[model samples]
Target chain A: MKHPPLLQAKNLKYSFNETGTSTHVLNDVSIELFPGEITSIVGPSGCGKSTLLYLLGLLDRPDSGEISLNEKDVLKCDDKKRTILRNHKLGFVFQFHFLIKELSVLDNVALPMRKAGKSKTASYEKARDVLGKLGLLDKSNRFPHKLSGGEQQRVAIARAIINSPSLILADEPTGNLDTENSKKVHSVLSKLAIEENISVLIVTHNLELAQSCDRVIKMRDGRIIE
Target chain B: MAMSLIGIVLGIAFFVITQAQTSGFEAFFIRTILGTNGAIKISDRFQDMDGTVSKVSKDGNFQFFFRSREEAQYTEGIRFPDEIRNALASYQDITGISEVLEGTAELAGSSRSFPVIFQGIRYHDHSQVSELNNQLIAGAIVDFAKDPMSILVGNRIAERLMLKIGDRIVMKGGTGTLQLRIAGVFETGVSQIDKKRIYIHLSTARQFKGERFAGSFFQLALDNPDKAPELAAQIQYHLGHRSVSWQEREKVWLDVFKALRISSAITVSSILLLSGLGIFNVFAIMVIEKTRDIAILRSMGFSRFDASAVFLWQGLIILFLGVLLGSFFGFLSTYFISEIPLRIRGIFSTDSFVVNWDVFHYLWAISLASVFVVIATWVPARRAGKIQPAKIIRETL
Candidate 1:
């Protein structure tokens, strides 16, 4: 028997209004992400790939669409409920790492669990375990600025997965890294998807990275082309 | 942030110091007045007599008539002085009660003569209510009492007349003139009292004024001066005599103090308001600078309320620290200012600055500053919470 999709979106639409001018960013886009599968959305600039990722992450509301996570409709959820869902059920990785510069690597990873009402000791213990798996246990006490590009991206990954979400969304996760760092981040993400049985979605312009995913969906002019 | 905190500290400190100074001045003036006149003075001066018009028209018709006005007779003094004193002495609240005879007299020195207001009192009974014994600069109350023919003169009166403790002076009253010896010289610090007043024995005043004149008034001191007005009212109601509290006697000065209080409040509020504005501006800038952090926090599942509480707590922490430091420095400043010696001799006299160390001033400073601080913090905190994560994320990323 086939497993059900972990996240589903149908006929999603979005737009941006700038000084009385409205531009449609996404048009009738739909996709299904299955558990333990790594999927990539590849498109050019202004092609709505990031917009789709944000929509799936529930960071922004689609103008018209149906979004369901684990067979439950999320469109009807209030802001507080949506935040809980984001903290517990979904994780996000951005291109810039976006780690708080003031916090140590361990504290950065522990933040999500802390927000989810976990005790500080439990959160830190879990954060240490994740860091040890990522080979960053020794660097956990150092601030984000002290880490290399690839290490910072890995810390961002650790933070993303700290709450053990069912799906992970990455928007150009390795866009700012060199060839070696990019490969390292790519391998870590693939390992996370298979080892944790969580859905992983990546939006990237790097064709090689897209080709490495289990499946790739190409987009043009706000609609899927493949 | 430092500047804003300093502003809060200075604002609260200034408020505290101003309150202490104002309260200090009021307390000093009240103590002087109470020491001289006691807390409550009972006399017939304020009593209302029956009208001179004894008859009115019976019918409600237009009538024109002329009637000769009769000479109005007034009560000479408090009626039944001993009864009033004895009745007041039984009250637990009344600490001391003394009868006083006040009249104008002429003091003729060997080389000079001056008009003076003389107060006559039984020394033993008067000492319980008045601070006259403590105020004597020369001779003692016991010595003054030992000689009934001797009188205690004010410092200014003795100085002007070039008299000493053994100098003999002639006192001319309404009825006759008598020769008297100067027993002591006292300084009450009040310029008017020291310059134009003298103390004579109550029996001598009666003899000097003749048998027709009773004592001028009875003065009573209470355990709590603040309750004088209420007790004065009660006494007047039961005894059929008019009673005036020290506060009522100094109504004009008290009114001036009230105005001072209002102006001080306005001034302190303005300072605090300016400080609050400084805090508001600092927080506003902070919100702008931490835009990216806010976006990240929101994206990390921090609710808007949590986001706002971050800034609100920051503002409140600053307020807390500022108030604590400000109160400490305010108390220190008032103490140092009060220690500075000053010689101000006038209607109101003091040798040093009077600083009131009431805890309420500190509490008032905190309460007033908190109002402005909370309002100042809430605006920017709310603004920080309202920042949209999607918009900020899009712009920054």
Candidate 2:
């Protein structure tokens, strides 16, 4: 049975204006994300894959496009609502493992929950359990710099899911990881997407990683190569 | 490198000096006013108003005016001259005692109008007359005498009136009028006192008032200048017998200190605002420099508010370090300038710029300087909130 799409984008267009000359970044790109599945977005360099992801994540708006989370038309949602959706419904992982180094691992993981108004003890306990599941329970109190590259990426994974987001959007998360770390991360992502029935989108040029996903969407010159 | 060090050094020094200036005045006011007057005053402040006061015994001989004789003994570390001497040896903190004396027109020369402070003084021990002289801009101090009419004129008044010693100046008091001769002209460093205040003999003060009266309510010097309220309390306890420390009895020196403080506060705040703004600019730039870090936090589920809080916290941490260090050196600078290794008085009694550990003062200066830190911290905190995590992440990736 094909249920409603968990993440939807329609006819998104974006351009960057430099000194009055328009550089068309994303032209008529559209994609849909569904629950209980992984969609790997494979694109050539500068193909606007990250740009589309940003728009879908409500991190930026396009020249003309509509995005919806579940059945809610999120393009019409106010800024506060967008922030709420981003904070609760959407979890993001970057290639750089952009964990705030100043914060302890548990704090970085618990951050979204804290923003969602979770009580301190509950947020801490939830983050701790997630860290434990990610095998970072012993490293919870350690700062990000102290963790190995693999452990740090794992911490980032625990952080994204700690808020129990319905959609996880990772932009080349394993791009900076070695093969072993990348495989370890893929296992974490695939297992969480399947077990929690959460929608997952990974943007990458790594063919092996892309080929392993349930479906691969290839892009060239900012349009889907259907 | 020199400019940076100068900025930091001068910034710290200016902050400390200006802060010390304001702090000193505030400290002095509390000491002089709070000590001289009670911690809080309950007085018929308005001239014709029945304000909150005078619940004491209403014996016709008992007025609201009184002083604590115990202060003198407690401070002298000696028993007051005898209880008889104590009874006669009063402690006075009078503003000015004016009397009208109707005397013979026996002066054969000049009859000039002179402003005189006819302090109804009985002895030197009680009337801290030297304090009046401490305010002298010029001229010598006169000894208190038993005779009537002989007095001292401030230098400015003497110069303005063009009259020296041996010239006669007449004054009218609240009671009878008095005629006094300028046996000597004394200048208290205070130009106001040098030009205006006149010291008249106590006998003449009584002669003008039509009775033989001793001023138990004259200007007094406290044992502990810092604990004036304690002195006032002891006065009420011991001398419920004599006088009151109302607004009327404060000396010119106290007012001078107050005016100095108000002006210093305004001046220091302006200077601090500029320096603080510089500090703020630096810190804001620091936040901007750490733009990537801030964006990473925001992108990692931290809201704009959380990012701002982190910056503000960092700025506060910087302020804590700078201010704590500045205060230590500010204090050290004050002490160093005071000792000057050469006994030199820099601009504005630079002596006060350096001081021993004064809690009331150090705390005030440090806190005032911290307000700038808050403003400095606030700018950067706000800048942190304006950061776009999405934009930053896109740029980095």
Candidate 3:
């Protein structure tokens, strides 16, 4: 049986003000996200791919739109409710690793669980379990800076899934990696969709990364063209 | 972090040391004041036409006459000694009560002569209320009690009169002159006391003044000196004697000591402010530099309040450690300084630098530093919280 879309955006619009001049960033964009699938938004720079991802991730509010997560109409929620949604239901991975330099790899992974009000022991145990699955159990105690670029990216992925969110959003997550590390990160994201039944939405410029995803939504001039 | 920690440590140390030094001075000053008079004094001069204490005086002391302000009118001392003594004895906090007669007289030795304030009290009762017995640098305070003609001269008075123990001096009073032997020499660490005060027997003092052999003021010792004001109020209500505490009688030194206190307070406040500004600047820069980190946390489901709380907790932890370190070093320095024999000779009558090593001072220092840290970290923490996760993620990508 086919499942309904896990996330849906309808007629989403967003604009930016630069030096008193208004510029349209995302113009009347619509998209749907499905469970147990990997999706990619491929577009040139400044084409609103990241803007769409941000709006879907609940990091930014669209100027005018309807965003529904599990058909709950998230756009109507307050800031605190949106934050709670992000904390418990959605995970985000940025282009850069952006791990807290002060925390250890394990602590960084467990941060989300802790923020979700998990106990310290439970958070660390789950953090270790996830790190081990990512082949990073040994590096769990190491600081972020002590890890290699690929290792840090893997750690970031571990942090994203620690809270077991329903959807994981990525904005060029593998942009800073080498070809080999890029493939490793892509393999991890693909495995998460297949093995964990997690729905993922990635914004990227890599054609290979887009083609490997279950669905590809191409964008140009702030609108999804294909 | 290191810079902010250093700033906090230094600022806290300065505050703690200032408190120790100021408190030391105030304690020594109070001790000197209370050494001559006890915590509370009830003068007999406020007796009315019916030979009774009518009311409390405006100055917190007994007033004999409410006549012209310009004219010098002497108030008769406490008339009802038995009744007042019985009233004082009823209170549990009243440790000791001594009847004293205080008047001005001149001491003439073979070589020199000087004016002095003579205080006569019964040795048993006076010794219980005053530290005179412990302050004798030469001879014995008990010898003065044994011999009615014996007197205890202050260190400075002894120097000026070129007198010593066993030497006789002619004391010229208002009505007559009498020869009295110096039984003891005391140094009270108060210039005024050492230079101008002479202790003798009440009977001898009365003989020199002629009739009405009544004590001037009843000095009261308390179990707890801090409770003097409350005890004095109770004493006034019950005994009908105008009670004066040490704080009331030593009003002259209040301004000088108050200036010291205010300067110390300002010094502490300024140091905290300057150090806080330094820390605030440091944290402000850290927040700006770590804007990306803040964004990462926010995007990972942390709220604005959580974002700021991280930095706020960091600052508080640093401040706590800094305050602990500062208190340790500050206490050592104050201890060392207190050991140095300041010998502020002939002024305030202290031998060594007095430093208050009270635990409350340390706690106060830490508490003050923590308050400043909270204030200093507030703006930067809030700024950190306001960082837009989407903006950072978008810009970085």
- lDDT for residue B300 in candidate 1, whole number 0-100: 76
Compared with the true structure, model 3 gives a TM-score of: 0.83
The true-versus-predicted C-alpha distance at residue B378 of model 3, in Å, is 3.0
Q: Is candidate 1 or candidate 3 better by TM-score?
A: 1
TM-score of each: 0.87, 0.60, 0.83
lDDT of each: 0.87, 0.65, 0.85
Error of 1 at B130 (Å): 2.6
Q: List residue ranges in candidate 1 displaced over 4 A.
A: A10-30, A44-47, A62-66, A119-122, A135-138, A218-226, B45-76, B83-93, B211-215, B233-240, B268-271
Measured by TM-score, how close is model 2 to the native structure?
A: 0.60
Worst 10 residues of 3 chain B by lDDT: B65-74
lDDT of 2 by residue, B205-283 (tens): 5566553332323333444444444444444444332223433345465566567666765665565566677767776
Better of 2 and 3 by lDDT: 3
- Index of the highest-TM-score prediction: 1
Shift in Å, residue B112, candidate 1? 1.5
Real contacts recovered, all predictions? 0.49, 0.38, 0.85
Residue A172 displacement (Å), model 3: 3.5
Which digits, one per residue and each the tens of the lDDT, describe model 2 over residues A1-226? 8978998888888988789999887888888889989999998898888988888888778889778889789988866677778888888888988787779998988988888899999999999999988888999999999989999999988988988999999999999999999999998999999999999999998999999999899887778885
Which stretches of candidate 3 lie above 4 Å from their native place? A17-24, A43-45, A76-89, A97-165, A173-192, A206-213, B44-95, B211-215, B223-243
lDDT of 3 by residue, B159-250 (tens): 88888899989999678899999999998877888999999898888777664435478998989988887677567545555677787677
